[model samples]
Structure formats: structure tokens, C-alpha cells
Target: MTTVQSARGPLDTADLGRVLMHEHVFVLTPDSQRQWSDEWDEEEQVANAIVKLNELAAQGISTIADPTVDGLGRDVARIARIQAEVDLNIIVATGVYTYCDVPNFFAFRGPGIIPGLDDPMVDFFVRDLEEGVRGTAVRAAFLKCAIDHHGLTPGVERVLRAEAAAHLRTGAPIMVHTHPGTQTGLEVMRVLGEEGVAFERVILAHSGDSTDAEHLGSLAEAGFLLGMDRFGIDATLDFESRVAIVVELCRRGFSGQMVLAQDAACYIDWIDPMFKGALPNWNYLHVLGDVVPALLERGVTESQVDEMLVGNPRRYFGG
Candidate 1:
């Protein structure tokens, strides 16, 4: 059986039961928070995440693939702290997150500075996968990069290419934060395809944000696993539309090519605390609490849900 790295340590893929393909224990802008936010309490945040994750484990979601990477302030040590308290497995990612520009850390150090020079991010990502992240001994289990409405800007392409190169070096899978409304997954299919990343080795995340079943179906047919993740963020798309897309895709016999998640984070500094009140259901429990019940009502079978929640993730981890 194949094994994948978790925040607690490595685990057999089969042990990753009823997986949520996307979720973040924390998502923050570290430098900004440290400089400006008084609400950034480390101890409290960790404690709160433990409580919430324990609640998630109670729902039978034994694993969550957290794609919080460099730009989003990923701290493996903090994750280890929470993983220690919870019954669930937290699989972290390694890659850069950028919709437009590469992080300043990567700006001038790579090939764009001068041709034929290898991009350092590929080695950095590979090291996080092979070795452990920043000496935390919590190795990353997957790669994450994004292509948003900004499209594949030069910086975005660089990060995506590095993730692809790292995937070639290591068999660990990839998760691309795609803006399906922009049809960015197609761009990913082209870029990653040219880089020799097999479609099965990648997940097109945030596919649920789009109501375009035809667009999602094409990607599934192309062999990429779709993350009908983001079940609770109804602000972008209403609850009914999100459920409808998943139902439609499953109707077309693409359940095996999909994975489910809420894309919720315990403490995200991205939104204003006042405004965060708008998304009440955008928490860890939305999938179990609401989405699944709605799906079953709409004719998505128990086995289809199992394929999306269990079988697909196991296969993605190479189980």
C-alpha cells in the first residue's frame, strides 16, 4: 500500500478515510498579522483549530488535504500541534500561491533572471516532499499552485511549472487552485500536460465554484480529478448552484473523478472579521451537515458520495 505524509507523520493511504480534499487549519498573511493584527493569538488559534478538527473527525472525515502553502503562511509545526490533539490526518502542501506575481522570495533568483538557470522553486518543492518542510519533520504530501482570473501571468506560470517539475521528480500529486469561471483548468491542462504531468496526478481545485457542468465534464473526461471542493462559500455561488453542479457531474457518471471538501479554514486573515459573518455555513461541517443531505435528495447515490469522498482520494494518494 502507498503511504502519504501527514502532519502527525506518514500514514497508509487507506487510513485516510472519508477524505476532504481541501481544507486549511489556518490561512494567514504572517508578516501583516505580526506587524498589525492584535487578534493573531497563536495559542488560541491552535486550540480553536484542535476543537474544530475534532468536530470534523466526529463527522467521520478522518483526513483533510490542507493546501495552505508559502504565500498563505503554512506552518507545519503549528499543524503538528493540532494534528497531535485531533484524531484526523492533516496532509499539507508545498508550492507557491500566486494569482499574478511570484512572491518576492522567487522574483530574481530563477531562469527569468537569466536563461537556462533552473528555477529554485522546483528543488524547494521537491525537498519539502522528499525531506521535511523547514526541518519540522512534517513533509508535504502534495503540491499546490493557482491560476485565477488574472490568468497564467508570467509569475503564475513560473510557479505552476516549478510544481510540475517537482511532481515529475516526486510521484506526489498536485492541486491547482483553478478559477473554473475563467476556464483556467484548460490552461492548466495545457501547461501541466506539456510538462509531462499526467492528468490523474493533478486535481483541479475549486471546480465547484463554477456552475458550468459542461466545463467540468470536459476536464473530468480529460482525466483530471475535479475538486468539487468549497462547499460552504456560498457568497461566490449560491448553495443550490454548487450542489447542482456536483449532482450533474455525478449524473454524467463522473463521480469517480471528483473529490469533495469545503475549503474552510479555522483562522483566515484574508477577510475582515466583521465581513466573515456573512458566511455562516463556510465551516468544516457544511459538507456533512448540509451538502451530502442535499446531494442524496437530488439523487447522488451513497456509493457516488463514497467514490467522491473515499475512493477518489485514496487513488489520488496512490493507494
Candidate 2:
């Protein structure tokens, strides 16, 4: 059986039904939360995450592929605590999420500064996939990294290569935070391809942020799983445009190459709370409660939606 690691334990890939490919239990700045925020209650946040995730499970979502890695405040122990209560699977990742510089911890240790040393990130990420996260037995099911509008800077290149290497080592799939606006997915294809990583093994996240179906179609044609995720984060691409793109892609017969998600977190302190309140539909429920219905109304078939939600993810995980 093709088994993907979950927070609870190993899960047969066939059991990963109706997955949200990109979601976070929490997206935090640990330093900011520790020193600046006055309202972070540990127990309350855990309880809140439990509530949010359970509600997602009630929607018939069998799994959530959380890409919350090192830079995104990945607290697997706390996630483990929350998973004990939720009914669905929470498959976590291992990688650095940096658009620019590598974290100080890795700054001078890798080849970036040392010139001839192996990237410690590869070992660390491999350990997470092979051994377990930190000291827990919950192995990471996938690898994650990013390249934004900043393009392939040295730091971003470092993390991407490390993640690609880890994938080649462990056979874990990778999700890259890409900027479709800058046509960054093309750069991602070039980079990971050079590292000998197959395009099918990589997910170009946030491809839905741009409505340029030609660019997205090219990436999909190239065998990259387009993450038509980020539904409900309307400031970049509004609800109608996001749903319309999916319908358009499905019409073009690329439903098998797309995946859906809200990319929602229970509490992400990135935006001001006041600003976050403006994104009324930016939650775990928005994709199913709103986007899916919208896609159906726009003439996308239920089978196509299932292909995106179930088949694509299962294939990506080697089910």
C-alpha cells in the first residue's frame, strides 16, 4: 500500500478522500506572537483549531495537506494535540518557507556560507520524512518550499534545491509557493527540473492568483499540478474570477491537473485582524461552501471536481 504519513499515523493513500491540498492549522510569526501579541492563549488557540478542523471534517473532507513548514510556525506537537480530537487527516510538510533569505539558523551552516558543506536542510527535511518531526513519531508526508515575485534569489534557490534534493532522497512530493503574476511557476519548473525533479512531483501553489489561463495552461501542460487554491482570498483574485478560472481550465480538459483549497488558517496573524474581517469568505469552509457550487453553476462537472479534489491528490501522494 502507498502510505502517506499523517499527524495521527500512517494513512493508506486510497483513504485520503476529498483533500484540501493547501491549508494551515495555524500560520504564525513565533517571534511576533511571543513578544508582541498580547492575546495569544495557548489552550484557547488549540481549542479554537480543534473546533475549526472538526467543522471541516463534518463537511466530508477526509484530509488536509498542511504546508505549514519551518517559517510558517510549524508546531507539530500542538498539531498532534489538535489531531487527537479532529476526525480527518492532517498531513504536514517539512521545508523552509522563505521568499528571500534563509533563516539565521541555516545562514552560515550550509554551502551558502561554508562553500563546500552539504545543505543541512536536506538532512533535516529527510529526517522529518524518514524519522519523525522534532521528537514525535509523526513523519512529514511531503516537502515544501517557495519562490515569490522576488524571483530565484540565492536564499530562495538554496531552499528550493534542498527541498528538491530531499524529495529525490525520500520520494516525498513538494509544494512550491509560486507567484503566477510574475510567471514564477516557469522559473520553478526550470529550477526543479535542473535538480532532476519531475514536474509531476511538484505542486505550483497559488497558480489561481492569476487568471491568465494561457500561462496556467502551459504549466499544467508541462505536467505541474496547478494549485487552483487560495479561494476566498479575494484581494488578489476575487471570488468570481477564481471560480471562473477553474471552470475555464476544466473546459480546456485540464481538470485532472488541478487541486482546490481555501489556504485558510484558524488564526493567521499576518494581516491586521480588522483587515482579515473584511475577507468574510476566507475560511476552511469557503471552497466547499461557496467555490464548488460556483464552479458547478459555471458548468464544471462533478466528476471533474472529484478529479481535482480526490484523484489528483491521491495520485500526487502515490496512492
- Give the range where candidate 2 is weakest over 10 consecutive residues by summed lDDT: 108-117
Candidate 2 runs further than 4 Å off? none
Pairs that clash in candidate 2 = none
- Model 1 Cα displacement at 42 (Å)? 0.6
Error of 1 at 65 (Å): 0.5
Give the per-residue lDDT of model 2 (tens digit) for 140-219.
99998999999999899999999999999999999999999999998898989899999998899999999999999999
Candidate 2 has a TM-score of 0.99
Task: Tell me the lDDT of model 1 at 90.
Answer: 93
Give per-residue CA lDDT, model 1, range 40-121, as digits (tens): 8889988899999999999889999999999999898889878889999999999999999999877889786986689999
